[model samples]
Target: MLIFLQERRLPLSLCGWQMRNRLIYLPISSITEWFAIPMVNLRVISLAAPFVLCTSLFALSLVQAQSLPTKKKSDISAPAPQAKTVSLSNIPHAVATAFCETYPNAALVSATWVERNAETCIKLHTSEGTKTRDLLYRLSGELIEMAETISPIALPEAVKETIHEEFSRAEILSAKRLVSAAPTLYEVTLSFGAEKETLIYDAKGVLVRKVEHLPRAVQKAFEAQYPRAEILAFSKQDEDGFVRWVIESREGQSHREIVYAETGEVVAISERLFPIDLPEAIKETLAESFSGSTLITAKRLTQVQYHISVSDSSGNTMLALDATGKLLDMDAQSEHVLLSLATSPAPSQDLKAEEDAIAPIPVALPDPEVDLAVALKPIKVEEPLAAIAAEKKERPVIIVRRYYAPSLGWIPPIMRLWRPSWWW
Candidate 1:
């Protein structure tokens, strides 16, 4: 730097320099100040200035680099923060006009401000009837994700195809939507176009299952064993946190219900069909996986997972740890869990595959506009919508009660006087 500076000027009178750290500012226009200080040799000044100039240039460049956007998950890794949220009230009429025009058929039931932004998260109930085509829209007057209403019977074929295509023969025993303003993925039924099929999606939008349908390849293997068997529409339930599809297969009119764990591949196809006498391979596998877990209870699936309960030495139940002792239950248990936990021992109560896929399976979500800067802010609350078709699920009777006396079943004639005719 000194050599360069000297070249730029010339072999002139030596002007001494004073530096604050590495600053090379020369005190000029003051002979007294200059003469008072000994001249720093041009050679030394050159060596020192180079380091100062380089460091200063680099520091300046770093400050500028900070202004550029850092890597966003949306761009590389997982989905980053949403775009800026715009309030519905604040959206221009043109945008509102576009929404109204776009989703004219969709019934707008409720709207809430998501991310405290411009777009409104709208809920729409598209039910053909009490039992047919019930859907929950996550539409914020825009095309986003959608979820199926719980116990939505007579599901539309279009929505059903979306599920089949997505989960594609995957047994979607259950699904749910994690809390999100505009979730990229859903935990509940997968949808394409207007149709929906019961399917659970990971937070990353990976498809896990469809109701009663295991992955196609796995189903084919199961089918090979039961050649003439046809599936009698089955009901799915969570047996120890796994989505177990209790399939009723009929061959030549002989029908029997068989439970199969839902999974993409045959991770652990059961060896025995009869009431499972704990297999040594399975028991040791669970013990080794849940190293410190205390085996609590064990239930058997015909061909898949052994639902067992084991808790840590500390007494906290080990709910969904894998065969390797890894606590893998981060999200709500879907029927898809049957596969992931196949080899692991259930060390607690048989967890049900989550029926309510999520708090609310959002359908038709808003175009995400979450500003990365403001993602940490609390999400605003919306008024709860009336549950139109929330089917009541009856808990299975674990213990049967025997009636001791006939009079206990109903009040005797003497107590009938208190019971009004209307009550009867």
Candidate 2:
């Protein structure tokens, strides 16, 4: 039987047997001489052929898979490393100078190095009130553009009305006042149901553009990073040939601003600040220097600067400070104005003083002894003509009454003195 099977020309129907619990047939043509077959009966070879062929195929597949070159984990491509943080030394001199010149008092919150149009550049993040400013600069430090993130309240009345008129029922998510390129405009984010819409309006509130969706990569990356963050505002910009997506989101008390490339790489990130997080040093300095002063607000202006609003006994005033909590120089007129305001008396206090000063003073009381004596002075009475005629007097008669007199003797009203009767 073995010799006959090795020939590869045996009758096709001669090999048949039960495999497992079922009958199986093995064609003679399928049996190769190279395959080792046990010296078993014809029925056994047929039964095992299918099993052996399957086993051999699986083993071959495994060997082939193992033989293929394996890729190292490090060989897998990943996104290019983005800038982490930046310092003054890493910034180009021209950029630093130009920035300082443009915004002498602007407080820098952060700086990042990014690639734009195949060239490296700097992105400076600053803050002023609820506004977060992003400035772009060339490698040579030349100013490219500046954009600010503004709150809904900062939107112009016209723009707000336009939004209201258009999306009357849509909830306004956020708004931004952009001051870049030509014609400053406003970017308003409105949400209706689960859909978010971004509308751009010019200074006059005229609709300039609308963005309903972002590039696939940018959206995917953003959603993956911040799945639960409520998107406040979104904007897109084209610098040279590179595109950037600016996204602002709020989660609970935290706020975040992210700039993304069209390729889904995060270029920069800035945490939006609130007044309650004013530096302790700033609060301490204000407390020690301006006692009884209350901090109204403290905003991050730059990486090393802050704009603080405070209310002292006088009034509310805004001042700037450096990173170390040192007071920064403000405009001469503004400094004088704020100082004067700080030193000047409050209107409420001034009014109170005026009221007290205008109050009438009480007149000095007269002497009670002199007043009583004057009131109790005696009175004199002249006799009438009829009484004088009745008395038959030849000369006019005078009568005097006194409350008290040493010269007059004490007498009851019903009795008259003998001397008084004679005088009468």
TM-score for candidate 2, residues paired by index: 0.32
Local error of candidate 2 at 57, Å? 79
Local distance difference test, each candidate = 0.46, 0.68
Residue 76 CA error for candidate 2 (Å)? 44
Model 1, 1-424: lDDT tens per residue?
A: 1311232333333444422323233444353364564344533455566579889999999999999989976467433333333343533344355555754544332222121133333322232222111122233334444444333233334445665664564554334333334543444544545554655454443555545445554376568777787653445556455555445454542334454545432322212122145788887897789879855324343333224456566764535543223344535555567687887876543344454343545689679777876888888765455232232234344788887643534666444544557663
Which residue segments of model 2 deviate by more than 4 Å?
1-86, 114-120, 215-424
For every candidate structure, what is the RMSD over all alpha carbons to the true structure, in angstroms? 37.4, 46.3
Best-fitting candidate, scored by TM-score? 2
lDDT by residue for model 2 (1-424), tens? 1233222333333336223433344454455433445334545556667779989999999999999999986566433443333455645678888877887766665665544566656678775444567898886877776777776887888988888898899998877766756888888889999989888899888999886577889889888998987665577876555667777676654666677777787766766454457678876778799898654323342233468888789987889853334465677537657866899876798788988789446799876555768678886666787777867766776898869545444554323422455443
On the 0 to 100 scale, the lDDT of residue 386 in model 1 is 25
Q: Which portions of model 1 show Cα errors greater than 4 Å? A: 1-13, 16-46, 69-146, 149-424
